[model samples]
Target: MSQRILHHPVLGSLEERHSVQFEFNGSVYTAYEGETIAGALLAAGVRTLRVHEETGSPRGIYCNIGHCYECRVHVDGVPTVRACMTLVQEGMRVTAGSVLPTPLKKGGHAN
Candidate 1:
């Protein structure tokens, strides 16, 4: 899938915007000033932000809004933050699924 900037027929040309640098899973990436974390990642061709706790299924942004938690990621040591709702800032550190705690077993011990 091509993630390049699109020239909308109605919107004509997209205005030139300032670019900021951020780290995704330890790799640096460039994103626009007002773009959300999910937007930036998608633009960079990143489809999965995390994995399912139980089945380890790759999960990406399912809802642009804050409703779904599929885009949950760790930002600056914080966990379970929704990527679709969080805006990307310069020098921000985003970890894909690493900060999520290990799943607990039936006896409450981490698996």
Candidate 2:
């Protein structure tokens, strides 16, 4: 995954925050303090957060204000947590939302 740090031309380098370890899709990732899960995922170059249960289509962060439900994910066995609204914490375990009964294979859609 590519580095997701942004270099603002006007604001210059952003202040560094303490790094924390988190897990996404069973993989450990580093996230900075005060950064939302969505932001950390984006920084890690992750786009798709979950698959729509009905349509089986991939969904990602949208709206980003806790209004839209597009960025839902399973965090620590809790289903339907909003990625954009949740803050990353040390040892956090994040997983993509799954379809009930069986989860659709990655990149696969319902027939």
Candidate 3:
């Protein structure tokens, strides 16, 4: 299989010195240190970042930088982390969902 990838904007002119291996959705991924998880996932063609709380809607990384809060994931047991802001470390564990407990809104008391 031939895979083509676009480099992240931050890696201007300098080659990635260290390549790290990690997993996403049980699948293996290789990315450079200092790169955001979302950017790495995008380079690997990971289009869906999350599912809606109740609708099961699919999501993907957008706005390579962390501004949209679209590529949120559970990183190393931490939830609600922005994939675009979190750098990928070797052997890091990540899950596809919000780590933060869902707030109860039955009476509009919590969010």
For candidate 2, what is the lDDT?
Answer: 0.88
Off by over 4 Å in 2: 101-111
Q: Note the residue pairs that clash in candidate 1.
A: none
Total backbone collisions, model 3: 2
Off by over 4 Å in 3: 1-16, 98-111
Best first by TM-score, ranked: 1, 2, 3
Candidate 2 lDDT by residue in tens digits, 59-101: 9999999998999998888988999999999999999986665
Q: How many residue pairs clash in each candidate?
A: 0, 0, 2
lDDT of 1 by residue, 63-101 (tens): 779898899999999988899999899999999774345
- Over 1-110, each residue of candidate 3 has an lDDT whose tens digit, in order, gives 21334465776555646889888888889888887788788778788888766557787786867788878888888888999899999998877973334576545773
Worst 10 residues of 2 by lDDT: 97-106
lDDT of 3: 0.78
Better of 2 and 3 by lDDT: 2
TM-score of candidate 3 against the unseen true structure: 0.74
